[model samples]
Target: MDLGIDRQALVPVVQQIISAVAQWIRNSGASPGTRLPSIRQVALDNLLSQSSVIEAFERMVAQGLLVSKHGSGFVVAQPSVLHEGQWYEGAEREWGAFVDNPMGELKLGCGWLPDAWRESDDISYAIREVTRTDTAGLFNYSTPLGLLALREQLLKRLSQIHIATHLDRILTTAGASHAQDLLIRTLLKAGDCVVVETPGYGNLYRQLAFHGVQLLQVPRTQGGPDLSALEALLQRHRPKCLFINSLYHNPTGTSLNRTVAERLLELAHRENFLIIEEDVFGDLQHASCTRLSALPHDDRVIYVASFSKTLSSALRVGFLSASTVIIAQLASLKTLTGFGTSRFAEAVVTTLLANGTYRKWVQRLRKRLRTQMAATLQVLEDEEWEVFAKPAGGMFLWARPGVGDRSRVQACARRLGVLLSPGALFSPTGEPSDWLRINVAYAADQRALALFRAMGPARSTSTILKTTSV
Candidate 1:
């Protein structure tokens, strides 16, 4: 194979070699499982040092593009089979249907909790200590209203974010999504209008639709949800609730500005509708304003947030803050639903809050996430991949490929051994986009970056995606 390498090029000899080899593989119509020459043979053919070829091969192997065998040599790697888009097969199965295969550790599409984040010894310690001290509450079923001490702690946090919610009005649920469901159940009836951001979180929308709510699509701009369109929908449909993620909105990684937030609250007041702001990504906000809730004022904003995003995902702890009246209604709805939040989880979280470890951990996490995000962005930019908005504090970057079929690109990424969350997963109809949401937390080092660069671009389109404005 002719590599067409420029020995004088400044792109580093090893990188050039890898790029040439990769381009050749794509153009040659060679299927995966094809084997290449040995390092010594390649070195001889290219008239280069053996170490250069070895380095290139090593890099390819790490990126999942090539696999190495002990006695034989390196061969093309197997293609990854990650599911993309939202297509529920049955009541139990949903988007990205993940079936655990026999090759246990070989997963590429989902964002997993790295070992560093899963060290839950500290969590264990906190839970044990709290259960010991609060023995009485530990044994009984948790109050539907949530533990008083935990509510007080949550209120203190709400206060820090400029949300002046009372302790009595707060209700803790299994997680942010749980809080979302309870609010939806309480406010929306079947066929009621619910405005959602286009290309928003698919599962949240799916949950709302499953409850028989009529969905109205509001186009999202970089500054946040398109207020003009939202106003039109509010007047046209007279919807029951506006489901928004005003800060660090999912998939797009966009947030609303203070001006827009005020205008949104004004519209809600005039329209006489409620706002259910999913606050899963609120902790990643770079702004100074409080997150928009179902009751921003006059008891119209219901604020939902969870520790799953900021802390461990296994700790499914989420809460909602609103007026006493709404809280009472939600509390009634919660009872008819599943059993209340876990006593153990709440007690453990409460313990973490009391000892101040949660705050410390959050600070450390933010710092690490920020660094990792920058590194991921730099790697993408280096390869000239088209990126959407520059998120202030979110953990993901929405990227579009320069050229190729989105599905094919995804297929290629799997074959290359790099797992990517395809853009179509966020959409309701499962329509493919030339975009992908990259989790910065996954690739935090040089090895990860190198793998990213070797994977190439996603499916390119004539109309490119712009960054969401904040």
Candidate 2:
């Protein structure tokens, strides 16, 4: 409010006030506890409505430029910034670096929603409520099975998909990856043979190898895993477990059908090997509710799901649904390893789900994902790239090269500041491939569309990624 008004300018009053306050904070070299003017005073001083000042200050609070106290009013806070760090070696570190700040690079391979797409008001409200009166959330450690209310809410989600599960059989973890880690620790030993989908979740390759488990690759089709190839693997290696994605499969965006699910369970019963279903993208699927966890009893299949994809990844709220025995073992391991998941995070997600905000957000997310998918596919098709399947709803679209060399196309993309995930990363053997997995959410950017279209005959084949490995 220190600055005079510029009504003749095109800027909105709210934005102008925001700009004035931001400039004042920096020019004054405001310390952390420095007080901001009251909303009413700012409104009166600027000759604007209280709502205008409220909106401006609310935005500042969300951006961490200001903090609001109950009765005293708003105070100065540090400015928010994006994550910054040096690149490190490892699949996890590689992805971390890619997302930190891609500059102008098109994130066609990233699997997350852009930061601008999230709904902050509801999250902010939930956080405030938790801090206000959330005793169980703030003071006590979460039960090994996690907050009952959250687990019960998740049980309702499971029921929606026809997968009947009880709270006693559910154990919460840090995320889906943590769930998988617990399963690996409890069920299998070193040198154990594990059936992994070829061209599947890329990071799992390193994780399994790190645990000293031998991987048996099974090629996945549009319906599911190639049953013929799978049965042969079971016959050859007698593996202990199979990790599969049934709905909106990662890197491929393919789903499994009832026939495939039934056939898979039948074969599992015949072969006596367990299946770990990674349905992390289940909530975002367009259709098809057939799950290995839904079929028969829960003896042979373990289901892992998370809120990371649809909700905030920083929260890390995920759970495992399986038989009572498996759940007990997982809960014990979770207790031994980390004691418990964050009670506050679980409570926040629980509130979102129970209040119906989370479902509405997921529905909106699905719609956005579908739109992005259609647009990405159209661009790829226009370029004569061969898509593996038409995904109904999901983040990924796998395709093979049609008009350009895979290596050269990727190299050219890098030069244009476009990061692309080549097919070789998805495969267990790391063999060269003509395929690429384009994340629909990331591809929605115009830069990505232009990048895909730019890979025509005009662009040169030689570039930096020609010999460099991902």
Candidate 3:
């Protein structure tokens, strides 16, 4: 179970586990036969006693939230009285499919760095140290604004990038997604209008739909959003806000220049709509790029960031920085949602940040990614595929097939145990395109390169694949 288990609850640990799992089932839109993770996996992931996890599962079974089949592990019960609305949709399922992908596949579609790329020793050490020293994190709920220590550390990080802000303006979240969710629930009504990038994060597109918000799709340029289209959208619909990836934007791996950032902020003020700038990839950028929040004289932009991409996605630690008024509102929304982010997650990150290991890890990780990005770009150029743009520095390389039945080529690749991020998922309206998002880290794999040659470029052009170096 990828459920957030609180170990330090005043209630029994088993009860805490039960609450987490039950809430997930109710909200996740899990199907009748959906199988939960094994008791051992859940125990190991959450650092809980195996007996406690087992007890929790048994209680869930009794509560009709789960059922145990003979040797099939715990399954979601039929006729599930889940939360209203479709919480789990196609976009989420797409991301989950990649997560649950079999190791045998060439996972060029994944969002995070591969498991082999992570500093397991450093991460494990942080987890162990936090578990040993921070007894309160294990049992207690996090503060509404999250751990002060973590926020303090984040303040320093923002300073390094010229994003000046105080701790009070920050609110920690489960991840960047959670921070976005909190803002959506807090600021938007069921039928409110909001603007999203045309080729944007699909997960956010689905999430906005879940909230029943009307999304105005703004096309993106290499530098930033198409400003003329954005102005027209604002004039026509007057959306409540505009959600965007500012620095090192996802899929395309492009950052907003200072001129564009200033223009966006001007539009936000004149048009009277908020700007939710998602800087999740900020730390990953090789250069110090200008973020929208850099012009913070007015509180129109809310800065969202995550450690998941740079550190460990499993930790689910992220935060948002905004004016005190906005932070207070979003923090309350967070309280009404999941109480706050995991205390354990906050403590683990705080420890790493305080000791300066977090900085060192990201620095090394960025260097490695820069190397991979260059090699991946070279391979794509050699194959004559059209790249969206050469990334300054980031994980993804959005590219077109240049030739062939894109759908057929994708299907063929998948049959051979290779996964590609289809372009349709990145569009707000699920519009089809020839673009594919490639993960730079995984591009180094010789097997993946061979598969790409044979199943991708080769199939597209009806030519034999060369077995030379990628």
Candidate 2 structure quality by residue, lDDT tens digits, 254-275: 9888888998888888888899
What's the C-alpha lDDT at position 69 in model 1? 84
lDDT of 3 by residue, 143-239 (tens): 9999999999999988888888898999999999998988998889999999988688888987798899998998888998998898887777879
**Lowest lDDT block of 10, candidate 3:** 461-470
Instruction: Sort every candidate by lDDT, greatest first.
Output: 3, 2, 1
After superposition, the stretches of candidate 3 with alpha carbons farther than 4 Å from their true spots are 1-89, 455-470
How would you encode candidate 1's per-residue C-alpha lDDT over 1-470 as one tens digit per residue? 54544554334567656656764565565566778888888888778888988998897786566788887788776533112232332212212223432212223234433555654877989877977787875677778888777898998888878887787889999998788888888878898877888777877777887898888988777777888889888777888778787776677667777777788889888988888877777765544644665234778887888888776678798998888988998888876786677777888888888889888877777777788778777877776778788777677777765555553453344333344556566666556677776667776644345435544444133212111000
406 Cα displacement, candidate 2 (Å): 3.4
lDDT of all the models against the reference?
0.69, 0.78, 0.79
Candidate 1 displacement at residue 291 in angstroms: 2.1
TM-scores of the candidates in the order shown? 0.75, 0.77, 0.79
Question: What's each prediction's clash count?
Answer: 14, 0, 3
lDDT of 1: 0.69
Q: How many backbone clashes does candidate 1 have?
A: 14
